[model samples]
Target chain A: MIETEQLTRCYGSLTAVDSLTLRAEPGQVLGLLGPNGAGKSTAMRMIAGFLAPTSGTARVCGHDVRRNPVAAKKALGYLPEGAPSYGEMTVREFLSFIARVRSVGGDKGYRRFDEVISRLQLEEVLDQPIGMLSKGLRRRVGLAQAILHNPPVLMLDEPTDGLDPNQKHSVRMLIDAMARQRTILISTHLLEEVHALCNRVAIIANGRLLADATPAELERQSRYHGAVSFSAQGSGVSREMLARIPEVASVEVDPLDGRVTVFPREGKPILEEVQTLLRTQNLEVSEIQLERGRLDEVFRHITTSAHPGPAA
Target chain B: MSAVFAIVRRELLSYFVTPVAYVFMVIFLVLAGLLTFYAGDFYDRGLADLQPFFDIHPWLYLVLVPAISMPMWSEERSSGTIELLLSLPVTIAQAMIGKFVAAWLFIGFSLMLTFPIWITVNYLGDPDNGVIFAGYLGSWLMAGCFLAIGACMSAATRSQIVAFILTAAVCFLLLLAGQPQVLDFFQDALPAKMLGALAQLSITRHAAAIARGVLDLRDVTYFVASIVAWLAAGVALVDLKRTR
Candidate 1:
């Protein structure tokens, strides 16, 4: 439902989004993973018809954003970074204004407005101005404004940036509930958010797309996938004893928690070898598990490997 | 068209929801009243017509109109709401005209509230009500001209103070273009034809012609044309600067 062809944006000498060609199909929640100043928001602004690309074009549904901006924008709902809003307007007044501007009026519009207000739980503060609301409440109001029209496509730039953990869970639940038969492209730097919400992840850095894959596929890129980690009650387990196994490439013991981890070689599984060692040595293990993957390690590796120079 | 109407409604609602509308109206009415009666010697002149009242409108609007328009587009840019606004299905032209109409209507309403003076003129002597009506029309039209210019200046920057200063500076130049002293300064350096054209560009010239009890098509056309030109500039500026 969302597509771009060599979409690029430059500010003077700096290229913010460089030759980005990507697409998001219906029923897919694509997570745009990038560090700060990675042009994620710039790319989104071009696709949302808010910023004109320096070259190439983006399309929403079937409408070209550059050629038919109004029609293209009609199909997608966008929450800009920081979720900026008119602070002087009440939540009710703000949503009503957006509905009218989007032409979401009449009986069906009223029903949709009611549903969004209740879904965002903005009933109590409907009459209060947005400036008086806390950050979490204001973000909710921004969400309500975005989804009020019930558009088929959504492009949210960091939707859960400043919300508390509980608020973040509820927002994720809302996005999850609306994920069926709709295309949602969300940009976030938080790695756990990708595992919790997105089905697919696209990693970008310095305005270039580095990796795009499913969450499971991305996790597999980490060295810790299929590795075994356990905490023992005694000093029976040592790095040298665990590293002696052929499948085990290396072993690391956490200095803080005193947990021992056995990493595999060539993405091989080392759980059985670690279990055999525990059985033979009779190690008193309190906690043990086969590590699926570590997203942060994968994210850091993928994002950093693309740029090999000194840190600027 | 509905999108334009929706924007207009929202802009008007925003104005009334804060103290902006009340404060602007109260200050405008007070200043216009004081200038008309005290500065223009309305009572001492003892004329049946509202010549003194119509005479001070251009200078009065020079400062007041900028105050009303300084926050037009600058506030949206500074607050980052421009992204949300343009992301809607509405075209940039629609947004520009909607905001312009809303501010024009507000200034028109303020102009209308000076009705007691109109009534006083009618109550005291046999004044030409048609001429008074023409003066009101001309005053509002001139206000629209200043507002259009201010809107363009507002779109050029994100700082409201910068927008205000730029607007006042531009309006001051336009107001002085037709004055005799300013013309004399340029007379020796330029041709008579160029001087005439410069004089014709003055808002004060066209407004004065309209306030003289004649709804001349030329004077009305001047105001309408300038408003359209400035608003078009504003739309272009908005489209160009919004990306940055």
Candidate 2:
């Protein structure tokens, strides 16, 4: 439903968004992860038809942003980075104006407005001027405006950036609910937001895509994949014995708890063999588990350890 | 069309929601009264016409109209709502025209409020109602020209102060184009025909023609064309700044 090809945006000698190519299909939630100044907002703005790309094309549905901004913008619901809104207007007034502009009016428009207002919990402050609302409520109102028309594509930049944990959870769940119908491309620094909400994750750094894959696929690339960890109290299952087993590349034992974490050679699965040893040898284990791989590790390793990609 | 009206309604409502609209109206009415009754010598002249009333309009609008128009786009930029406005489905031209018409009708409303003055003129003497109507029309249209300049400048800057100052400076220069000094500056450098053409472009030339009850096509064309030109520039500037 959304795509960009070689989308480059440069500011003089500095390239803010460099040759970015991204896609999000219908019913897919793509989490765009990057550090600050990663050109995430810039890329989103270009795709939303708010900012022009220095080169290349950004298409919403099938309309090119630069060539057909009106149609392209009609297909998008964009929440700008700061959630900027008309401060002088009341929440109801602002949403009504958006509904009018988006042509989401009449019977169906009222229903959509009520639904978004209830979903975002903007009832008490609906009549209050938007300038007086707190930041969290303002963010929710911003979300309400974007989704009021129920567009096909939603580009949200740092959607859950400043909210408290509870507010963050509400927003996450809202995105989760909405993710099943529309294409969602959300840029966030929080990895857990991706874990909880995203079906696909794209890791970017220095305005370049480092890795784009599903969560399981990214986890499989983790170094800790297939490693087995167990806290054994008795039954004489020693770290030496685990290391002596076939495919056991290395072992680490915790001095405080006498737990052993084994790493398998050639990325082999050692959990089944270790479980067999525990059954055959009658090892009394307090905790036994296999690492599903940490996304934080993959995120950090790919973002930091890898080269910074092509120069600006 | 509904999209344009949505923007227009919102813009108009915002102007009234704050103290800005009331303050501008009070200052404008007070200044128009002061200039017409005191500076232009309305009673002293003892004429049956509204000549003095229309005489001070050019100078009054030069300062007051910019104050009304300087925030149309500058506020959008400073408040960061320009991004929101552009992200919507409306085109730049539609947005610009919507805002332009809102301010235009606002100035028209203020001009309409001066009807009591026209009535007072008629009660005091036998004033030409047709001429009075033409003067009001000319003043409103010329105010549009000034507003277009201010709106364009506002789009160029995020600071309303800068927009006001720049608009006043440009309007002052355009007003200067009517003065005899402009000819002295350009008389020797350019041919007489070119100098004459420059003088014809002066705002006071067309404005005076209309105020004198001569609604020539050229004067009407000049105001309408200049309004369109400046508004078109405003749309272009909006597109330019949105990309930045």
Candidate with the greatest lDDT versus the true structure: 1
Q: Write the per-residue lDDT of candidate 1 for residues B13-89, one digit (tens) a residue.
A: 89999999999999888988898889989889888888888888989899899988999999999999999999999
Candidate 2, residues B199-224, lDDT tens digits: the string is 88889778777767667888888989
**lDDT tens string, model 2, A75-154?**
99999987999998999999999999989988988898999999999999999999999989999999998999899999
Query: What TM-score, over all chains together, does every model reach?
Result: 0.98, 0.93
Between which residue pairs do clashes occur in model 1?
Answer: none
Indicate the residue-level lDDT of B1 in model 1: 90
True-vs-predicted CA distance for residue B221, candidate 1, Å: 0.9
List runs of model 1 lying over 4 Å from the truth: A235-238, A306-312
How well does model 1 score by local distance difference test? 0.90
